[model samples]
Each structure stands twice: as C-alpha cells, then as structure tokens.
Target: MQTLVLVAHPHLADSTTQQFFKASLPSTGVTYRALTAQETYDAAREQAALRQADRIIFQFPLYWYAAPASLAQWEAAVLTRTFVYGDHRYPLADKELGVVVTTGMPAQAFRRGGTENVTIDALMAPLAALAHRAHMTWLPTLAVHQFNYLDEAQKLQLVVDYQRYLTQPAPDTLANRQAWFADRLPAMVAQLAPADRATGELIVTTMTQQQDDLEALMATLAMIKEQDDD
Candidate 1:
C-alpha cells in the first residue's frame, strides 16, 4: 500500500530538524509530497494524493496545541461531505491514518496538570472525530518532544529513526506491540544511526480504538483470572 506523508511545518527552510528529515527520505516505492512551499493551498492536489494513498500519515509539529494551520486549512477546504463524510464515496473511509508530531516541550507538559495544561488525547480530539466519521483506522500517534534541545548529530539520527518508525508495520495488539518493542529495543538502541535518533525518542501516544480494545481485553483476562482463583 502506498503511504502518503503530508507535512505541515510553516517554516521548513529555517527548521534544521524537519528539513533534514524531509531531505533524507528514500523514494524506493513510497510516494512523498511536501507542501511547505508558499503556494495557494490546492485542494485538488491534496485530495488526489489522499485518494492514491492506502495509508496516510500526517507529519507535523504541534502548533498552538493543534496541527499546523495549513493542515487545518486543507481539512476545512478539501474534506467535504460527499468526498469524506456523507456518501459512500468518502475516499478515506477504509484507509489507515496515522499522526506524527514533533514538539518542543516534554511529555509531562501535555498531561492533566502539566505545563502545557491539556493532555495529548484531549488536544487531539478533532482528529479522532475525523477518523470516526471517515471510518479510517487510527494508528497510535508518534510524538517527538524537545526537538530544539538535540544537537546536530542527534537531529540527524532523529530523522533516520523517525523514518523507520513511520514505516514500521502496525502491531496487531498492545500486548504484541509491547513484546515487539522489548525484543527490538536493544538492537534499535545500539545501532541507532546519526539521523534517526530524534524520532527514536518519540512517545507513541494513544489510538482510541486500540485503547478501547485493550480495555476490553484486560477486563476479559481479569475475569478469567478470577475464575482461576475461585
């Protein structure tokens, strides 16, 4: 399936971290298009690209507790009722959707009483609604924090790492994901390339569907455990 990475960083040229990440992409089989250049937001281009993608990953730095303005603009202008919400013609209905965010603050800042005030889940509510309305499978969010603190070498490593993480297959379940991380962490940590480390530190945040499924699984297991105990 072709994965489309739609980026929305306002100042891509001045950005050391995001720029490097964009430049280092390998074409192989994946189709990539960057919309950072100052152009009149084209709905046709955006919708066409989206239609071609089997999986769509929105890559951006969180701006003012939400996605970049351009993304919001695209969403408003392009994702119309007939195309995205109302009719069966909603192109995104059966595809996969993922979010990749880079932030300046620590993870704690986005918590209940943390510096940023609102939690990540609360801030991402709009996207969640969009997923449900579109019937797209919402993958876990990939969030990278403290991008400004990383040195040049660290920044490079972050880019490479982010690419790998984005391309990695979605694990079947939370338990399976945890197991995969445990098995892969040692090697992933040791062989971390220069341009891949930034994305390496990213926290994969919640996907509502996955969370609900995990809760149900946990409740079932608890009941089984109680039966065994009895």
Candidate 2:
C-alpha cells in the first residue's frame, strides 16, 4: 500500500516553498510524481499510481481559490467514469486523500469576514466533495498559511508537521467517528491509565468538534448537489 504524492505546481523550478517542502519529504517507500512535464496529464501514469497506492495526496498552492491548473486538468482528464466510477465507483475506497496547500495570506485572513472573507475549509469544498464521491477517506487539510512569514525554526517545525500530517492515518469521519470509538472502547480500555482514564472522557467529548466540521461539509455538499440536480 504505497502512498502517492501527486505534486501539481506548474513552475516547480521557480517555487521556493513548494520545492523545500517536496525535498524535505521522506522518500522511503513513498511515490512522488509530478504532473507538470508531460505534454498532458498521462492517464497511464495516473492509473498506475492509483493502482499501486493506498493513499493519494494532492499537493499544491491554491490558485484562483482552488488547486493549480494542472491538478484541475488532471482531475478532468484522468478520473474517468469507467476507471473512477462505472464499475469501480469507489476506486480508492477505504484509502486516504488529503490536500497539502501553501498560502501567501496569513492564517487569520481566511476567517469569516476577514481579508479573504472565507475560511480555508470553505475554499476547499470542491476537493472535499471529490473525496466523498471517490469514497476515499478525507483528512483535515494541511495548510501552510503565511509561509513567507515563518522564521527558520518555524519553517522547520512546519515541515515536520506537514510530513506527519500527510503520513498519519486518515482522521475519523463524522458519519463513522462515534461508532468507531464506541466499538474500539474495549481495546482502548487496557491502554488507559488510572489517571488517564479519568481524562479520557474529555477526549471523546472533544471529538465532537471534528464531527461538527465533517457534518457541515457533508451537508453543504449535499445541498450543492441537490441544486445541481434541479
């Protein structure tokens, strides 16, 4: 189950931040492929990667409130109905998909009524929906907001965090998070220390924050699809 990192920056040669992030990633058993050099998105390469991967990550900087042009083009050209749908509607089912993005604007700028007037999550709705339809587990987006403002130490920390975030197992989805924990309580019980067990209740309670986020996105996508259907 190889993890495929699909990098989609048009001008990788000129990108400092993205290049640094790419170079920092550990290559042990991980497949890193770029979608830039081919005269067009190569379906054979895309399918081969998909066939061999257990996780697929879309890494890019946001462009026009979305992914780089190459990513959008790859999606349009590679994710065909026959391969991604038709018989294999869930081509990547039970697999993981995440977006790793670097933004020029400060993190605070994306808050509601802030400079961008929308959150990062809002801006990434299309990818979230794509994850759902493809049946790939969607993870919390990893964002490098204000990549230019971070100091050397901070940049190093961000690199480690980004690497960890990309490699970690997919976060529990809202539709299944509670049920998953409930079923795992027996296994989790033996690991809980006396003092830790007392605090464990807080862990379950706080997970609702993640659930609220997933539910909101799912509901929003549902409405969007409904409008499209009409």
Candidate 3:
C-alpha cells in the first residue's frame, strides 16, 4: 500500500524524533512531505498526493495540545468540497488515516490522572472526526512521548515498531505480525555472516517447533472436548 506522510513541523530539520521516525520507514511505497516555514502551500499538489495514497499519515510534534498552523492551512486548502466532499462522492473513501505525534512530556502525562489530564485519543478527537467525515478509516495513533529520555536500545525497538505501524497490512493482529517478521527473517538472516546466519536459522527453527507444539496441544484439547460431547 502507498503511504503518504504529511509532516507538519515548524523546525523539522532539528527534530530528533521526527528524523528517527522518518529514517525508520522503507524507501519504497512511502512518500514524505514536510511542511516547512519557507515553502508556499500548493493545494493541487497536496490533493494529488492524497488521491494517490492508500494510507495517509499526519506526522507532527504536539504544539499546545494540537498540531501547528501549517497542517490547519493545508486542511483548509485541500479538504474542500471540490476535493473531499459533496457531489455524492468522497475521494478519500476507504482510505486509512493515521497520526504519528511526538510529545515533550512522558506518555503517562496524557492519561486522566496525569499532567495533561486527558487521554491521547481524547486529544485526537478532531482528527478522528475529520477522518469519519472524509469516509476514511481512522487508524490507531502512534504517540512518541519523552523521546529525549529513550535509550539507544529503546530507540532501536521503537524504529522497528514504528516501521511496522506504517507498513504492515494488519499491524494490530498477532498472526499477521508474526507472518510479517517471518517474511523478513530470511532476508535478514541472509545478510548476516556464516556463524550469525546459522544462529539465526537455529532461532527460527526453535520458534517454529514451539508453534507446532502449541498447535498440537490445541488440537488435542479440541479432540478431548469432542469426545466429552459424544
């Protein structure tokens, strides 16, 4: 699926979180548009980009509990009746709408009892409503909190997770997630040295064995239940 990432950052070049997140995405099937302070807004180009994408992601740093003015302007210019609504048609129908937001404070602060005193979902309600109005599917938001506090290992894992969020077909499902990793494991193992490749294969084998064993146990339980019913 084609993904269009619209980044609304006043100073995108300096943001560590946005840079890392953008770097994590694969080069193919993804388009990045950064709304910088100097660029003039082109409504036609923006509308064309939205029309081409199967998934549209709005990436931004949270400013005073909302996105920056650039995104609002883009919305006003592009999300008009001529392009998004009216005429008994919706250009964005069946498309996916996702948000990736970065926050200076900790994630815990977004909850009811915390500093922000509101859930992230609550804060993103306007975007969700926009998606609904546009006939787009509203995806779960990826919120990066206290980004400066994360260690190297944590950041690495975050990249992997964020990449999956952007590219995976069924990111929220365990079976699809396992399949996605399994599909990548072989190519990843091929890139390793001889000894590392051997170790990687061994790990994959062990995981496969465990999965088989669990499936067998489930089958046995089902048979036992069938006999009890008889």
Candidate 4:
C-alpha cells in the first residue's frame, strides 16, 4: 500500500529512537514528510499527499502527553471541513490511519496502576478519535517506550518488528503471524550450519504444529459456545 508518514518530532535529528525507527522504514511505497518548527505549513501540498496515500501515519515523540505543536498546527491548517468532510464526501474515507509514538518512560509504566497511570491506548485516544471523525480505519498504534535503554540486540529486534508493522500486507491476526514465521523460518534456518539447520527446522516444525493444535482447540471451543447459545 502507498503509505505517507507525517513525522512531527520537533527534534528528530537528536532523537536516537526516531532516527533509528525512521531509518528502518521500507525504501519503497512510503513517503516521509518531516514537520519542522521553522517551516511554513503547506495545507494544499499536505492534502494532496494524503489523497495519494492508502495509509496515513502520524509519527512523533510524545511531548507533554501529546504530539508536538507543529503537528497540531498541521492538523488545524490541513484538516479543514471542506477538505476532510465536504458535502461531496470525506476525502480520507476508507483509508487507514496509524500512529507511531516514542516515549521516554518504560512501556510497563504506561498501564493501569503504573507510574503513568494510563494505558498507551488511553493516551492515544485523541488520534483514534481523529481517525473516527475522518472516516478512516484506525490501525493499532506502534508505541516505542524507553528506547534509550535498549541494548543493541533488543534495538535490532525492535527495528525489525517496526519494519514489519509498517510493511505487513495483512492485518494483525494469528493466522498472518503464523504465516510470517513460516515464511521467514527457511531463510533464517539457511544461515545456520548443517548440524544446526536440523535443530532450527525441528523448532519451526514444532512451533507450527503447536499453532495448528491451538487453532483447532479454539475452533472446538467456539463450536461449543455456539451450541450453548443456541
């Protein structure tokens, strides 16, 4: 899908998390617009870009529980009634809206009874509401928390997952996830030595079998529940 990423980080150059994350995005089928504090907001250009994209992503570092002022200004200038909700039709209707937010605090802290005292979902309600108002499908938010603390391996894994989030063709579902692993296992296993390849294959086979068994069990339970309802 054609994706447009509106980056709203005020200091994106200095932010390690955002820099790494931005670099991880796919090189094709994606466009990046970095909002700058000193730059003028071009509503016409922004609207045209949005029109061309199948997926619109607002990416920012969480500032005072929200996006930066630049983004807010962009929204105010671009999301006009005539453009977004004219008598003709909603321009963004049926498009997908997504959010990618980076937090300085730990992920665990952004939960009920935690230090932040609110879930990331709760924190991102405004963006969700924006999608609803614009008649767009709201994709799950990608929240990167405490990125400064992650080691090299963890950071690598995060980037890999982030790339998948941005580029994955299918929605987040168990079947799709299983298929992703199945598709990657062979290439991953090929890197292993001859003796280790057998072990890697066995692991993949076991995991696939377990997934199948779990799916079957869930189906049986669903059937039982349907009968009970009847």
Q: What is the TM-score of each candidate against the true structure?
A: 0.68, 0.71, 0.86, 0.79
Candidate 1 vs candidate 3, lDDT winner:
3
Ranking by lDDT: 4, 3, 2, 1
Q: Candidates ranked by TM-score, best first?
A: 3, 4, 2, 1
Residue-by-residue lDDT tens digits, candidate 1, 15-105: 8667766776644435665555345666777788888887788878888889988787767777877778664666787788888788889
Residue 2 in model 2: lDDT: 66
Output the lDDT of residue 183, model 4.
70
lDDT digits (tens) for residues 1-230 of candidate 3: 89999899998879888888878887568898888655666778888889999999999988999988888878877788778778868999989999999899898999989999998899899999999988999989999998899999999889888877777775476556766677677878898999799999987778667776866787898899999995
Model 3 residue 159 CA deviation in Å: 0.4
Cα miss at 15, model 3 (Å)? 1.0
Query: lDDT of candidate 2?
Result: 0.77
Model 3 is weakest, by summed lDDT over 10 consecutive residues, at: 170-179
Error of 3 at 137 (Å): 0.7
lDDT of 3 at 121: 91
Estimate the TM-score for candidate 3.
0.86
Residue 26 in candidate 4, Cα distance off native in Å:
1.3
**Model 3 score (lDDT):** 0.85
lDDT of 3 at 225: 96
What's the lDDT of the predicted structure labeled candidate 4? 0.85
